[model samples]
Target: MTADEPTILATSAGYERGKYGIFDMRPGPIHHFAAELANAGEDAKFCFLHQAVGDPENWIGATYAAFAKTNYRASHLQLFPMPNHEDIRTHLLDQDVIWVNGGSVANLCAIWRVHGLDEILYEAWQAGVVLGGVSAGSICWHVGGSTDSYGPELRAFTDGLGWLPYSNGVHYDGEEQRRPMMHKLIGDGTLPDGYATDDGAGLVYRGTRMVEAVADREGPLAYELRRAADGSVTETPLPTRVLKYQ
Candidate 1:
């Protein structure tokens, strides 16, 4: 795979439940996404890195159950804390997809750095692995993002893997404080102008260029926020193609 062939699928929020109750996982669309990454049913290995969860094992079972419904048959859904069964570099290189789990972005970054998974992940990405995840998982790929990782208050998080040139904002509609905080950061030059996605929507990128915005639900939009010359942030809605779950 070439440098320009790298695929990235990132979502603001997934089909998981909070206090509101359970949301359908929409396995069809997710399977389709996995199939695309797997290159039309060819065998692919999926690695689920849950360092963000703090305790990686906490969500491993749920993650496995979630992806088991997907078309990608070969998956390595394990926690970061598990004893390495193989060399980390070799393990990452063998994966066709690297799915990150959401939790604390700050903590995740720090952990990955300490374990050298950051560099390993970058290598995998460069070698054409599809890097993806939700929430903090999505946020870590870009230069920065608006996050509540530190505490209850959402703030600008400017340290990311920088695989993508710009920043990002997730849960655009799901979280009330997210929109305003992202806008303020971009407008005030605290955060770089970048992309934002509502829950259920995702932005697909081929390398650093955005190829498309996709959603599993109706009315969920993705936006490109840019700081204009006048120091105001302008939000341009990117057309999103709704993925059929059937």
Candidate 2:
């Protein structure tokens, strides 16, 4: 990835009511986010990857509705369990912005590997495509992160695509178990010292380094968790710029 490559915007939360919900009309920072992503790409070919949903059409319509509000056009491809599908690679490579939807992080990673999408996405990023997402979408870009993909109990997921060399934890304020688990994991050396974001907040990484923290809400924050020499965990709050709705 070049220094001038667009940063990956990973959000902890946004408008995700799924099908039957309005995408472009939903409140908050999504429309602005989508428009910015579309503008950066120069081409508005927005592609959605919803492998975590396990259903091809489950969230595609809603995703399309959301992107339609911007200058871009949207499309979704179902890759889980469909290896023989034609045009899969073409669609992925052609996307100016690839938005990954949230779901089971483990399951999404597993399927992406099976279809070799992990490598494809990395190459796409290297080619200047803007990659962004929420929750599991956010987690997939890190080296690891805390997740509840296996069961109700949250655990460390260390098999991310590794585009970013740190662990990640989403929904920092929305979920009760997330904060404590992220702290314990980094403190115990089970996971690398990494970043965490509150709902509606986003961490922006230019290449592999985090450059800024942003939010849709006024008070929501993002943080960096590090382990001290004495094995205690420290949370450093990052400066955040709250985005205005367009």
Candidate 3:
């Protein structure tokens, strides 16, 4: 219930795996990312949860392993692959950080509700766990998550973990087809209003404070989607390349 009690770092883009240099055990911005979580005072244990089917071989596991080698001193990193409903439990109370990977939001939500993972995550966040995720991982935290590439006729469910009241649309700038697809879906009454993010960008919320941070060392953009007074959907660009080492 206090400000800055838990600092969350959500990345819109997938975790970069190829020698990012941040997790290289050297002094730099990327190293600072690892340090931020590694240097957390007492009561912090990294819980890297991998989502989706191919995550074990994907960038998610690689990213976590890299972080573990350079930062996370904890021994165990939880791995949850596809159909994660049965794995959902209230045991997260013992963790100080929870990181989800990018994957199918529909499947994630389905399994989340079936096994009550949503409530567990909420409890973890309130308990001071630094909660975060990557692409699909970040979008699912919002309300009425975006339904762009998943098909117009097949709409994913609206109810999410509800970490935030608003919904988010990831890869707004990088995905050329997502913007128009989102507008069409919203106009057709398939999806509610939400925000969008660019590749290598982030929309982080630490407690009640929200800040936009870019992941890559170069160009990456973000956007916020809202309904106009005239009932029209609009996309507003967000500031990018604006964060520094802590």
Best by TM-score: 2
Give the per-residue lDDT digits (tens) of candidate 3, residues 1-246: 222465555567544444654343222242245235434543345555554333455444455465554444442333344433334444466655566766677766776666566777777777666676766677677765554426543344466665665666666666666667666655555566666667767766766455655555567666667776565788777776644653
The residue pairs in collision within model 3 are 22-30, 172-197
Specify the poorest-scoring 10-residue window by lDDT in model 2: 22-31
Mind giving the per-residue lDDT tens digits that candidate 1 earns over 2-31?
223777888864654445332223333643
Question: Ranking under TM-score, best-scoring first?
Answer: 2, 1, 3
Each model's TM-score? 0.88, 0.88, 0.73
Measured over all alpha carbons after superposition, the RMSD of each candidate to the real structure, in angstroms, is 3.0, 3.0, 5.0
Q: Which stretches of candidate 1 lie over 4 Å from their true place?
A: 1-4, 16-28, 40-43, 69-71, 74-82
Evaluate all candidate structures by whole-model CA lDDT and list the values in order.
0.76, 0.78, 0.58
TM-score of 3: 0.73
lDDT of 1 at 29: 62
Candidate 2 positional error at 97, Å: 0.9
In candidate 2, list every pair of residues with a backbone clash.
Answer: none
- Cα distance off (Å), candidate 1, residue 30: 3.7
lDDT of 2 by residue, 125-240 (tens): 87767788889999999988899888898999999988899989899999999999999999889889899999989988888889889998788899999999888999998998
